[model samples]
Target: MADVIKSLNLLETLKESIENNKLSDVKDAVEDLLISRINLAVVGDRGDEKATFINCLLGLGPGDDGSAPSPSPAAPEEVACYLNPKHPDFRLWDLPPVPSTSPFQPEGYMEKVKFPRYNAVFVTFTQTPHPHSVEVFLEARSLQQQTVYFILFTSAKDTEKNLEEKRKASLVALTSHGVSLPKVYLVRPSTLEKLDFPGLLEEMARDLPEIRAHALLLALPTLTPTLITQKKESFKALVWAAASLSGGVSAIPVPFVASMVDSSVGVRILTKAQSSLCLDNESVERLARQRGADPARLKELRTCVLSVEVTKGEVKKRLAAAEKEIATVSSKLVEMAMPRHARSVSRSFAAMLQALNGAIDEMAADAEKIMAAALGKGK
Candidate 1:
């Protein structure tokens, strides 16, 4: 209910801007929407484990260009920043191992890593939760870093009882340190769908700032159907803003020329959607490689035309076609939200909304198929 109202308020704000011909403001809003930044810090001792966890988070295979390096025992002593290939604004910073001192001190380590800057923190360990790891979480809590995770990376071959025991031990250790309520996530980075990985992601989505959470959802690889659905729904507000921006830009008075602004907007929207949904060539190939599946075979699973390519010419044609196909139904709803003074852009807005919505649905469906095929499920 509150979320729905908030969404409606945003839509109304955009509509008001379009009605008043505030195209520049609308453009800024859309730019901010598409480029929000999320800084995630993965704090753990094991270089190999950190690399694997970071790779899985960023949808990269071990050998991919932007994947974290599983450095030898002599890992780099400084913080290493791993850029998300799909979204430059999003970053994963792998901090050096917390010093294994008898009396763990987190202040110097936190300052060195600029801990306050990260939107969220993940403290990971292979077995027992390190004393340093718990101290780090406690320090982060004191510093108002509310979004933190204590993760135990367990072997897939480990029995359920063994996993439960490890979690209990970790919780006990955390509680002993005055943590009122302690929660630990047991995961296998190789298979994020197993154990507590999905729940951890859900908590991240709920706990982080709204825009950063949205960025995380869209930037992550389409691993689970639940995530796929969340990613698809996250685009709703973006689609509305994009279409409104298109309408607003076109509404601006230009001497003796018809504005074809929606084409460019549509192209940008779908291109971002393509990458966010993991329909782009690079993302598909990386996921395929990570799952030991042939990239070409996975690519064949993407049946949507826009999922394959989003171009200006293609966008223009689709916009016109979608407008014609859904105008009767969409126009009524769009018209209700648009003011009388902004009627000129109503058709354009409706067309862009229709085209982008259809493309997003098609791309999301294609991503599901690709993921299924990559996971050895028949397409």
Candidate 2:
């Protein structure tokens, strides 16, 4: 059931590539041939370019003074989100990832480049959703959906009256497609800040469901199985992602048990002074639970063994070393757990990395099956 659903996602990716002329459906029929397995291989054009294309699409293209070859553009021609671990463009990078190379490279890039299977991708800007912008968004939504559905993200950029005027224009353009009703959100960043600034930042945050979607994704395991089952393998709409965030640790009593992970957080100072990995099973279990890992599912996964080719000897070695490494990482986590500004953010960020590691292990096993099949090799 999982493989079939995953393959359907591949079909969606293939369809977009075909329409864009990156691949010939008839020529690359292997992608479509499988009925029981998901195509883990990321087969698509350059998403970084697509990211840049998106930038250009949104009229934020390099802000080129035509200077310095326009900073070499982030990427070229596909559905780029963010594939690089080294990417430093934004202040906070909350997007998730898988192991990838040539993050700038097209080969095996699609699967590696994580994206929100957001049914409605609301792109909020200080500007109104113009007609051409609406058309671009419509096509973006159409390329992936069976019958075109999506969202419009905006900020109450002007005064209340002007905001209403822009909202009406955007809403009208968005719903203009009689076939769909777009999801919309107004950003308000001030929700995180108690201080006063020009209201622009608050206005932006008010409608920033897109940004929130990234944070929400980190906490996605909390989304009930029913919502997940309905969407199958796709990302929940930003609205749904937003809805699920209410289940995060922040939503819990005393916010993260208040002292459970923190009591040992100070060990980081000692560990950093000497370099160490001090977290233990209790800590990991607390964290794993905090990360929302299902003990039952992990047990089930042990039996499934989707992919693990290393010898028992190697597995033991990695397990031993990783055990040791966890102690060092744990101590460091404690250190950062205290920094005023980066405290929760860093902790959540670290927790996110841990979650990604688990997801990668699952995906790796799935990927190696196809990888071995393609390479004509076997364990």
Candidate 3:
């Protein structure tokens, strides 16, 4: 609730600046509001499986022969850290597996990998549990700063029965050591298609702190309908912020300047939504190609990528079309003797909000269409 209030206040401040023709102040506020980052650590003893899972999560396609190095059991000390390409702010740290033969002090192991600073950690396992990993999870639970954990079962079949058995066995092993478990997910690293993976992602989105949850949602690939819906809801949560920013432009004293600023703000909001939904040209093209879509159709889809110029043009066109309706209402208000300034500000605010709402709706629909086409549900 505090965060909500803070966000509202920030949005209002942004609106007030726009109303005052404070372009620099508006830019600064938008920059501050938009800054977000998330740090994630993947830990497990099966180094190869862990690498495969991380690669798949990043949409790097197992990376067996690609840029992402496949971790080998022989090199248990090798660690990889990189920002997710789709979301530069999402930092993923692949911690090397703790060798069973090495010293098994959980605190020492965690410190060795510098895991204390990560926002969230995923402990991966296979058919059997590693005693050292279980101990590390227990230690992690006791840390001064709370850390989110997801117990991942990698390189597994997608059947619910198999997943449940593996999850139960892992739980039993952890319980034997007096360790309470966090959420567990069974993932097939090869295909990244699992019955529970979406649920796991939803739980993470629901459970993590706000900033981290927002970053995670932006970083995730649109692999399932549930995930796509979650992305939409996450974007929807920011509409008020966008609308507030638009309404702020209404206060600008200069004629036409407020509308220009509103156009840019609308573009920014829609672009952010497009990126968060993974509907950018590159993502959509790659997904289409992978789905065996026709070459010409893929080319057509790529052209639908969101752009600032296009968004601005659309907003201007819509505003022009709405002017007649606004004029009719304004004339009625004038006959009632409403102040001209009040009527002008009302028209400007309405136009700005309408433009933003229209842009968001169009971008969301494009994202859904892309997702459907990729999933073989679209023409």
Better of 1 and 3 by TM-score: 1
Candidate 1, pairs of clashing residues: none
Please give, for residues 192-248, the per-residue lDDT of candidate 2 as tens digits: 111121122223223333223222222122112222232223222111111112112
- Model 2 collision count: 21
* Candidate 1 residue spans exceeding 4 A from truth: 1-29, 72-76, 102-104, 249-260, 335-344, 377-379
**Residues 219-260 of candidate 1: C-alpha lDDT, one tens digit per residue:** 777878777777776676678767665565454653311333
lDDT score, candidate 3, position 344: 42
Give the candidate order by descending TM-score. 1, 3, 2
Candidate 1 or 2, higher lDDT?
Answer: 1
* Root-mean-square deviation of candidate 1: 3.8
Model 1 residue 304 CA deviation in Å: 1.4
Better of 1 and 2 by TM-score: 1
Q: Lowest lDDT 10-mer window, candidate 1?
A: 251-260
Q: Arrange candidates by lDDT, highest first: which order?
A: 1, 3, 2
Q: Model 3 lDDT vs. the true structure?
A: 0.58
